[model samples]
Target: MKITFTFILLNLCIFISAQNDSINDKVISYDDKIILRLNLDTNVDDYVISSKELNIKPRLELNNQINTSFGLDYKIISATVSFAPHFFPGNNNNLKGKSSFTSYNFRFFPKNIIQTLSYKNSKGYYISNTQDFVSNWQKGKDPYLTFPNLRIQSFGGSTSYIFNKDFSLKAIYYQKEWQKKSSGSFIPSLNYEYLIFSDNQNSVKSREHQLNLSFDAGYYYNYVITKHINIAPFAFAGLGKKWSSYKSDVTKDEREKQNYFTQNFGAGIHLGYNSERLFFGSKFNYSGNHYDDNGSNILQNNFYVLLFFGYRLDPPSKVKKVYEKFQDKIPVL
Candidate 1:
């Protein structure tokens, strides 16, 4: 009887181990496969300055341009190149002004950590609230006050950690994996950025340099609707500090320094379908930032809708061999 009892206990242990492995296997991984993606998004940046004491508000916005991005993912790294195509309808409208935008971004996912780096450059802006300043401005016929020489550039990145081991952020973001069960995670991130803003107007060149740092606490939930469908919603809030330096060619007192406190919040939702080789998704996102500039309130905001489609293919033998050689030296790869 003692021997029979020991046998039963051993069998039970084996059964439980098999069940655990089965659950883990449901999360499909495409790490060995290469993925190519095409994305389209309406993501224009805008700035607003308002002063209650002066009863004045001015809004600056880029043209309504549609941006297209191409991305590639291999092993643990993902990279993307994005630009605004001139063939888009509103991009060629002279009423808004000639504008250009380009960006490059890369992301790495290793275990529970996510790392990102990016750079963006944009030129040209217009006063979106021209009606407020003009006496008899028509809605579609009148041209906006254009800033053809204005430009802005930024270099930024973020590092985030996921607390829940079962939740897969890459499943929703990069489409490199798929999660079978519904799960959520608390993700905390640290972000930093350096920005340059310059404009040459009326032959006077003015420039500003800024450094910003922020921390955010965010919650993301992946609700599995079916084996091939899911919807994810996320939100975050953060506080930050900005250090700024301003210089102008026209003024003898050319250097000025200022510091400001900033607050930001954002929320977004994504709906996606995933299959063995194909994945597609749509997302809607809104983000806003506020800071005080010399007693005047400055607000910058972005609202955009995005659509993406991607396909996975088998990696070539040469590519796999190269990655294997480096994987030992870099465990994260």
Candidate 2:
């Protein structure tokens, strides 16, 4: 009887081991697939504005941006780049307002560690009723001045560790620092500013410059909806310090140069479906950043929406070659 019992236990252990090995192999195959992604559609990038001195609360509104992105992915790494052009349909004579190279991110996953290198350009709307700021607004010719946009650019990298299949933590760092510029091409326009409040009303244009090094840590939880679908929700909050310089274009002089502390907090949700040969997802995020100087503050609430579809790129070459050979038979426009 003792020998029979020992034999049954040994067989059960072997069966469990085989099942675990099969699961690992399936996961590995999915991770190793090479995939291509196409962007379907998206809404205008929205921004919210607020101020302490103006008694105006923050509000979210769509901007005049049309954005598109292309991406490629594989087991070890993934890359994405986006271009956004500001457009106004009412003004047929007006040129495209500005072409913003939105974001570039390269992400890598090696076992439990996830690494990311990213560059981002963000825009925020500003509204003020103060006499000083309004005076500057009335003098400007750029239409963007009435709804001023703050352009902030940053290049940074982040690292994260997976504690388990359901949980992870991430930390971000920026070596170069975040900087602010006007809403134009790489080289700003002469009188492109929408608002400028200073001692001299002769402020032909103005640009706000910021130098900030920030750090943030966040937690993400992956909630499984099905074998192929999952939703990951995350939350984060951070603090940093920045040196700001407000510059007047004509005089080439700095109006206000000061250092202040800033705080940011946000949360987002990500939904995705994954298989061995295909992956697709969509994400929506909302964040608010604020900094105060004297009696006024620069506050921004930002929202991001992205949709992506990816499939394994291993197309049949023989079939493609046959189709290409007979392409001349098809009618052309």
Candidate 3:
């Protein structure tokens, strides 16, 4: 009886040892510092910009463009490059002009610090009605005319610190160095054509330049509805400056340049489903800037909706070979 008991005890010990060895091997096989590649993301954003000086009411426009992004994820850094391809037929003459878009985003995550650097050259069509010079030529009564397409090229960066999983603080700066550009509408046929034209010029331009900087605290909470579905809601508020120049190409003397301090606030909600193979999401955000200038309050409201889809890809043979070469150099401790 003593010999049988000894045999059973030895067998149980060997079984536990083998199980521990298996767990250790599994942990050693995965390197937390490795990078992932071949991730593709598709995004579409519909943007609306409204200001009292631009239109009687804000016009919401579908950009009708697809933005493609390619990203790489390393240990604590992620970088992505995105571009919009203009291949589809467009009916808007304002967009028929030259256009280009390129964006670069870099994210750094080291413990509680999260920082992002972004540069973008975004070109889009904008419409504004001609100012009513004569009482008979009423502004806001006519159709929304298109002219002076906007090309906003900016370099900006933001830094955020995560206090916890659901809360963070952020600061952003854009166009620190003021750059000047022209935006406005072309000459349109109104009842007072003679009054609208000066020095035989048929076009009206507003030479504009601005700087934007803001700081805000944000709260985001995620609710998991299922294994693959989740929803997130977020809100933020901040203040910034909107220094703008409003001028006419024909009459430079009749220009107005003002430095206005603006307060901004925004909120959004995101709903998405994420899985190992595919990911999709939709988000809607509304942001507004309010300030007082010359005894009148000016507010610029911007609303946008984003739809995104992404796919995951396995490492190709060439990528695997490079990864193997990198692994071979690591010394076993």
**Using lDDT as the measure, which candidate wins?**
1
Instruction: Summarize candidate 1's per-residue lDDT along 67-87 as a digit string, tens digits.
Output: 999999997779999999999
Better of 1 and 2 by TM-score: 1
Better of 1 and 3 by TM-score: 1
Q: On residues 1-333, what C-alpha lDDT tens digit does candidate 2 reach at each position?
A: 233234433433333232111212112243333467766334343434445557655443334434677776643446878655444342221222332337787765544445565666655433323334444544234333232344556555544444543122211111000111111111110000011222223435556655554455556655556667766677877777766668767647546788878787777877776665666778787877688778666666666676767677553677455544664453110
* lDDT over C-alpha atoms for residue 198 of model 3: 16
| Per-prediction tally of clashes | 0, 1, 0
Assess every candidate by TM-score.
0.90, 0.58, 0.56
Sorted on TM-score, highest at the top, how do the candidates line up? 1, 2, 3
Model 2 lowest lDDT segment of ten: 184-193
lDDT by residue (1-333, candidate 3, tens digit) is: 233234434433333232111112111111123333232223332224444465454342223344556656533346778776566443233333344567887654433344465666655533332233233544435433332255455455554544442221110111000111111111111010000111112455544445455566565555556656656677777766655555566657776667867777777776666555555667677767677767556665656566656554565677667666764673110
Please estimate how well model 2 matches the true structure, expressed as its whole-model Cα lDDT: 0.48
Superposed by TM-score, candidate 1 places the C-alpha of residue 308 at a distance from the truth, in angstroms, of 0.5
